[model samples]
Target chain A: MKIMPCPLNGPRNISEFVHGGEVRDMPNPTTCTDREWAEYVFYSDNQAGIVTEWWLHAASGYWFIAERHTVTDEIIRTYDPSEIFNQRVEFSDETTAKEVGA
Target chain B: MSATSPESLSKRSFVYRQLAGASFRDIAGGAMATGVAEGNNNRSQAEQSALLDLSVLPRTGFRGLTAAAHLQAAGLPIPARPNQASVTGSGELVLRLSQKEFWLLGALSDSGAGVDALNQRGLPAADCYSLYCQDSHAWLALTGAHLPATLAKVCGVDLREASFPLGSIAQTSVARVNVVIVHHQLAGVPCFSILCDSAAAEYLWESLLDAMGEFGGEVIGSNALL
Candidate 1:
């Protein structure tokens, strides 16, 4: 089997990944209704072209979005959903500005 | 960490805190060429009877009371492989889940005899990515009311039974030693049987001791943890 780089899991051998149908776009769940919601949740585009999809990095225990060409598992780009949500939090442990001023 | 039920979700009863930084030891597939081998045999058969201490046994090793052992299902995680089921033999239990795999439970010492039986039945060792994991290395199942809390100090996995359930098993680093977390519970208490690199045992033991302090747990040697 030929080895290729996957966005996640660093450099795992190609054999480890199974071709999960065509990766496609997802509609916003909050705004969608009825068939649109059903389609968004239950259907797959399964097309053969540049597409953005969700891939399960089974070995590495990560799930992320990938932009790739359907015909070739050649991924165009990858982004970590967790990283996007990982904004730095600043906690206010102890210090009240009003009290200090007064 | 929630204030009221911090222990439930903080993942830090003690040893469970390492879940974030732990390098998971993947127990799937066959073991490396060089792995843990304590000794092939211990001469005293009489001692063999008492060699194992089941008090600390995980739900998996507690399996000793039962005649059942593991039946390996190697090369099975293959996507297209169908009808692959999980069961046990008299030696060891091996199974695959999602993209991961596990070694059910077995007696490390008596493993060869079990493998010999499988070989006698015409199944070759090379048939699948199979190893009598019991013979593959030294394993200790640290199960108790405070097991997950005790293990948190040295391990990195989230040992919550809700997340890492009884069937869950993974090969990951503990106390910096490579090990497989064999998920097993005892009387509703979550526990793990850790498999490690043989030479790394001392480090793991010390780590376990350091983590077990808060629970008023005393240090137990391998003989005790057995």
Candidate 2:
């Protein structure tokens, strides 16, 4: 059985998973031109090398990113999206100073 | 008649008559053993296991970043992680399906309440999520020894006692039907509570019986389970 290691559910059959499309950054829709939006939706790299993509575990509905070699189809590693796309909240010096009643 | 909810659509299981209709009766021994290959009995045997229909129970589901806090407000403890189920003293089962999703099974309140209690307690935060009366799934409990062996025929995960001890849940496919299997002990007997989509309930039920036939399995009533 070809096993895909799920970050949460552990290794399971490949059949239990669904391949999400390639991971790409979303251009700011309000600022980008129409052509850029079209390209984002309609283009593909499909390169034959190590690439990052999204995968969903069918049973649990858990989604994670997998880095795999295109030619060998071997998964290099799998990780949760939060590892890379973590949304950080930085408190400015002004805000902190005001909170302390400066 | 007009379209009925999935819960009221099927009053009994497909094999209810075959199992003698809510009675403590057993199907013919080895009833499904003819087609399976021989020597399959050496691995395990199923006993005192019965399949009961629990579709009539009230079920409500909710999920969001604040779901745990909402449940705690309702006086139910928040399960720490995925696949963990906590049963309240009142016999309500809360299963944490994922980081943000949870399914509340059985009655949520002592008044035999439906979804109101869930919505009421989860308020203010209720705007953050919605409580759904999920009639889409069929529920059953399989209790006995060798549950792992029987489940192995359909699911790919290891369900043995050591690997999948008590209080763990598995959201996996069984007989090609998406289902949630919760490990629990009923009356001190090992039991696995399975919930699957109502559309494929009959097919999954039959498949489970076929898998257990080689081990001398029989179907009993809910009385034996509760």
Candidate 3:
């Protein structure tokens, strides 16, 4: 059986994990065009070489980032999301935007 | 003497329907199986290989960025790292599923007083929130000598005592269903405590029993464990 190393639970059977799409930078919803937002939410680069992607360990409900080689289907490394997200992200309200515009 | 019936309890086990022949007694606000038949070899069966339902027992969890600090402030001992567990002085099992998530399991001897106390206290910090494991997960205990071998039939993890060790936790799939397994002991008898989705309780219980049939494992009551 293929094994995937989980940042929180150590090595486990690959069947216990679910692919959660690629890791991509988010375009500020308030400033980016609708098209840009759509692309961010719906598209992936699908690169041929090594890529960072999201994975979920179904049992623990833990989500982490994994760098894997697309062509060889080899998992290079896995790490906790905390390494990338140190602080919480907050979205500004429409009223705040209007106040700024005023 | 007569024992309480599960049908009479306000709270019942997720697999209560499957416990038709077992004797029941009040515990943790629900009916727990005490024996299958009077004068039967339930204790012996448990010492060899047996499965016990603990779905109605008290269990609670907390998670978020500040959960660890919150639990520590409440005077509970926290594991130093994720996927580890610590037994409390009062016999409660504290499991650190992740850096920010901890689950408290009430000790059978106290009928879950430790967990219930924490649940009653409520979450005081906004960064930490309560996890309703009592309602969302079904708990089961597998005991005795053949636990590792029986689990090997359906689980891919290496649960042998040498590798898994006491207090080690594994969040993995068993029989293709998600489950959290903790290597723990009950009344000095080593056992594995399994927590799984409430909806899959019956299915997993039957699956485990089927896997254990070859080793003479059978359903046991909480009396055997205590």
Candidate with top lDDT is 3
Instruction: Give the better candidate number (1 or 2) by lDDT.
Output: 2
Give the runs in model 2 whose Cα sits over 4 Å from its true position: A87-102, B1-47, B107-122, B131-133
Candidates ranked by TM-score? 3, 2, 1
Candidate 2 per-residue lDDT, tens place, B73-160, comes to 7888678988889887766678998888888876312322533466556354353475453557777667678689889988888989
RMSD of each: 21.6, 10.0, 2.6
Superposition TM-score, candidate 1 onto the true structure: 0.39
Instruction: Kindly report the docking quality category of candidate 2.
Output: acceptable
Q: Between the candidate structures 2 and 3, which one is better when assessed by TM-score?
A: 3
Among all windows of 10 consecutive residues in model 3 chain B, the one with the lowest summed lDDT is B36-45
Best of the two (2, 3) by lDDT: 3
Stretches off by above 4 angstroms in model 3 are A95-102, B1-3, B38-41
TM-score to true structure, per model = 0.39, 0.78, 0.94
- Mark the regions of model 1 whose C-alpha exceeds 4 Å error after superposition: A1-102, B1-92, B95-104, B107-116, B124-136, B186-190, B219-226
